[model samples]
Target: MFKRVTVLLGLNADAVADHAKASATVVKILRTLTTTVQGLAELRNQLGLGHGRAAPSPALTRHARLALNSTVTVTEFVIDTWQDRIDRGKLPPCSQ
Candidate 1:
């Protein structure tokens, strides 16, 4: 999911990788962000609501808050990147 979104937003590392103009920091940050989200997805699959649990969830309020905050940060970053691409005309106008 992260890769797909990254590609759609023109944030794919391949676009910038192997290019002298690329920012190493940006690529590293994106990779880290994707890994963090992937970790969150695994946490959700294991302890989050929806999957049948024989007992109570092990998650605490702090855990939920962390996940929520991480989600918001990731979402905002992706949206900002996408808008930046559109603004620079690297991407075409979004059609609803």
Candidate 2:
């Protein structure tokens, strides 16, 4: 989600305020998702099976983690790449 948002922000590189707001929203959503992940993990632990709880099938977990890591990497890449423009008042002024 954050990476998607970051990509969108980069596409709007000529617009500053909108990009700032979009970045803030993405950060908020990421925080919320992190919290949700923790809660889900707690719930999974609480519902342990009588015979050792089965792990998520490796195939499913593998791609899910990879996707998540990829997203974070992309988000950081966007942030690092454009942060100078954002800070130096280089982005174009918002329209309308």
Pick the lDDT winner: 1
Per-candidate total of colliding backbone pairs? 0, 0
Global lDDT for candidate 1?
A: 0.83
Which regions of candidate 1 are displaced past 4 Å?
Answer: 12-22, 52-55
Instruction: Tell me how far the alpha carbon of residue 76 in candidate 1 is from the true structure, in angstroms, after superposition.
Output: 0.4
lDDT of 1 by residue, 1-96 (tens): 887888788675444546745666677878888998999999998998667767777999999999999999999998888888889887887899
* Clash pairs detected, candidate 1: none
> How well does candidate 2 match the true structure in TM-score terms?
0.34
TM-scores of all predicted structures: 0.77, 0.34
In the range 3-76, model 2's lDDT, one tens digit per residue, is 45445445334433657777777666555555554554554456433247576433456655655665576557
Output candidate 1 Cα RMSD: 3.4
TM for candidate 1 is 0.77
Error of 2 at 68 (Å): 15
The lDDT per prediction is 0.83, 0.54
